[model samples]
Target: MTRSVPQRRTLAAAAALAVACTAGAALSTAPAPPASAASPASPAPSASAAAGTASGYATENGGTTGGEGGATVRAGTGTQIHQALCSRAGTDTPLTIEVEGTVNHGNTSKVSGDSCDTAEDKIELKRISNVTIIGVGGGAVFDQVGIHIRESRNIIIRNVTVQNVRKSGSPTSNGGDAIGMEKDVSNVWVDHTTLRASGGEDEGYDGLFDLKNNTRYVTLSYSVLRDSGRGGLVGSSESDRSNGYLTYHHNLYRNIDSRTPLLRGGEAHMYNNHYVDVHESGINSRAGARAKVDSNYFQDSRNVLGTFYTNEAGYWEVSGNVYDNLTWSTPGDKTNPAGPDPESTTSVDIPYGYQLDDARCVPDIVSRTAGAGTGLGESDGRC
Candidate 1:
């Protein structure tokens, strides 16, 4: 079976063994070691000592801190446990926080808990820089964001699985956005992660990942976004004047039905991806943004290429693709065999290339279809 990110609620409760630190005198009393540990390590130096010393683990009130401080926190049974870890990092050193095992939160009764309040983001990276949060072999889950990076830079979140991220029990608030990078963050790379959300009352905002306004130089690759109520991956400009650049490549997306509108921003490149069982459209480019969708595979997807309702002088090169078990939103009338609806026509050229008999629909675009062949007829024409 295909692997998916775990639900936030489940992770919050089950993965609650990690350690946490808070600001102020609370540091005087460290929490107990996880049940699995034979003997936990002592806490790092006191906040004052850390600040004055030249050692790597220094403390700062609000300014930035440098050097790598390795901290391993167990995923405990609630958001409180996760929050403690974020707080203990003291917003200083570019912490390399590693997590292992399962964590659960929101719901009560360690054994028989239901969905608790959304897990309030397992780790909140706020106004910090140069941090790397990595997860090893053991799986981890979060009810909200596995990692919420806000107003930070030079951050890398890799090799993690963030499943079932929801805001609240209410349908309007039930979006399982696994990773949310918001508030003018830049230089971020989210790679090799799997995000999944399923069976929630709310479908409008169920995205596997999202990058908001004032975001630039961001890359998402080699990830899986599936079984969500919303889109697999999304990016948006919070304001009309704000600029954003995003690159989404080599990912697998399946069964995403969220209704949050597609992004319309500066520049976006989406290429060499696989899409399957999508509810609305496989890939949507809206709001006048310039996007290049090429060399991808689309199987049993709804609207293969939807450039409907865009304003930002868009351009698309739809070529060298194999279309099998694919349906267009607007199949052409008898008069127009090519199905170029007047509304669908743009300054760009979207030409038909090849149709393969295999189960996969590989596009004929040079950048997109070079990696995977749909076993359809070969295309002599360049994309």
Candidate 2:
């Protein structure tokens, strides 16, 4: 789906306040669990069952053996494992499975009639729930999405590396997103994974993780997102409406632009993360949304943070952030820089309890590019 840019600065002040409020709350509370645990009765399905009818099985000399209660099949030398896993019948029973090995044209030829390319297998999870697919150290690479979950819920994807996934071939909308969660999916966790867009120069897909519609209670943490043509992480709703609590913490975004906005109506929290070499603002909150961007380290970013083209009712709070080698728009330039910038925006009325005591905002490069001359400064705010 496409999004029309909203009016810049319309809700900037309110967004700043909301960010401050959320940051205060987050600072006062202890860290929550990395992933939400499901209820006892709703156990995950078996590895074999999760990957319907395991047809192929392959393992490296030292690869781990046995499925973890679900359809646990070590991908063998060919596409048999991928095909079997993708076509397996999904069970409502919650399951935890591990996928290992590398599958490309080198191993399996094609997945006969599957819509996905044959060299790589595309597994579709339809209406499955309470499933966790963890990757062992060996890694699983897919020419397309390693796994696609649609209309599913309460799922956990951890410690996996997905590469070479593209959305389209066009420069403007090419490079398929690595993980696409249709509108109906909810309560998912994606952590400790690396999503790289090797399709250089192509308009690689928007998000390493993409969610739409009523998808809720999602967490993305400790992952590395890089080389995305559009943005590192992207999320949206069909009609400026969203469902669930979204939390993104401790992830690294490198060489990316236009990070996802907290839009379509949901509660979002982004904290304790580091952003390096980003071309756009660290966080974008829009369309009558509420989000918190706090305690993040931003380095070499064009624009630091922004709330643009949002409805009047939209809210955001940004605080406890350290900006290094950050830049704002050129003087007389109304268009904000692409990444987070403390100087370009205003401070909200919310309580900013955490201050960068001379320790933060230590600039390695600050020069006059716009209206007043730019220079280095220290944080006077309380910690």
Candidate 3:
């Protein structure tokens, strides 16, 4: 379903919007409350009418209507969450789980059942469909626990925080990813969530958000991923090229070393994200990946876009992006950077409609609207 790329639109209108601070006034950029601050009131609206409604790829493939027209349950612990899924009427029975408070390994355990395939030490959503897990009340934090989605579809995770999960430490979960999806997973939307790790791979942390093994039709918006060596990757390796149709918008990536994220092979649309302090590399699009990189702000980063560590190249069509105080590495047999200055090597036609924020104000806009809580606040797109 490839459409011809449209002519590049001028950014004159976006540049003129530099003075519209009030447009972003509705967002909450507060640093306290840990980004996992309390949750929005519930008896939530259906998927089509919810606040901070999902856009982008998640809106395609028959659209992601997670747990719509279903019963709602409250789960405070991982065990309770597993129980909720186990109690479903059928494998595809729609259900919504409103999570509150802290969920740690101590309070989480495997629950065996007919409807789900559960595992120990992780919040496992596997071999099921039509479910929503949203933070509520005082907030939901998966402390040292990770969320794993496999062989699932039509799922949503919102307004929650998962941090400090590790692969080599005393406690490990989901191969150390804050959230991971694989094995034919599709139609998943993760929004207004915070995913962080204390350090890099050597320090036991893996990726913050990762997808692999044919996962598709996913969107990660208004989220925050930071302080990890690896932000995430689309496919596990250059040969693992079955994943595609991902949208990452209005998110913040701070102090990430690399792979923000490494796209092996796929079509991805990335816009309005703020990338700061990317020490090694960012947005490694390689192995024939095609990305529509638009209106993003990259600051204090190195090699923010390119094929790295391999000669197999990827292509991108970039526009309206602002690179501030960035450094470019010398091109080598194994490193091909997209800067000094970046230009389009290809074009991508997006199928959905989205509002673009001025690149100059992305940091401010993202800060205010991204991460958990803030009642799933979103930009009115005036900024």
> TM-score for each prediction?
0.59, 0.62, 0.88
lDDT of 3 by residue, 1-383 (tens): 21211122237644554565322221223321222222322333333323335678999998887887888888999999999999998879998888988999999988888898888889999999999888876788999999999999999899899999988878877588899998999999999899999999899999999999999999999999999999999998899999999999999999999998899999999999999999888999999999999989888788899888899999899997887777778787878888767889888888877767667768876877789765677665443
Distance (Å) between predicted and true CA of 39, model 1?
39
lDDT of 1 by residue, 92-199 (tens): 444444444454344212221121112342455567675555444343444444466677766665546667766664322223356776767776766556777764
lDDT for each candidate structure: 0.45, 0.48, 0.84
lDDT for model 2: 0.48
In model 3, state the lDDT of residue 47: 34
Total colliding residue pairs, candidate 3: 0
Q: All predictions: root-mean-square deviation over Cα?
A: 17.6, 13.3, 7.5
Better of 1 and 3 by lDDT: 3
Q: Of the candidates numbered 1 and 3, which has the greater TM-score value?
A: 3
Question: What does candidate 3 score on TM?
Answer: 0.88
Q: For model 2, how does the per-residue alpha-carbon lDDT over 243-329 read when each residue is reduced to its tens digit?
A: 546666556667777564335456666665566776655566545556666566666765556554343334567666666566654
Query: In terms of lDDT, which candidate is stronger, 1 or 2?
Result: 2
User: Candidate 2: which stretches are off by over 4 Å?
Assistant: 1-73, 76-90, 105-121, 170-175, 199-206, 232-240, 260-262, 309-314, 330-383
Return the clash pairs for model 3, or none: none
Give the winner by lDDT.
Answer: 3
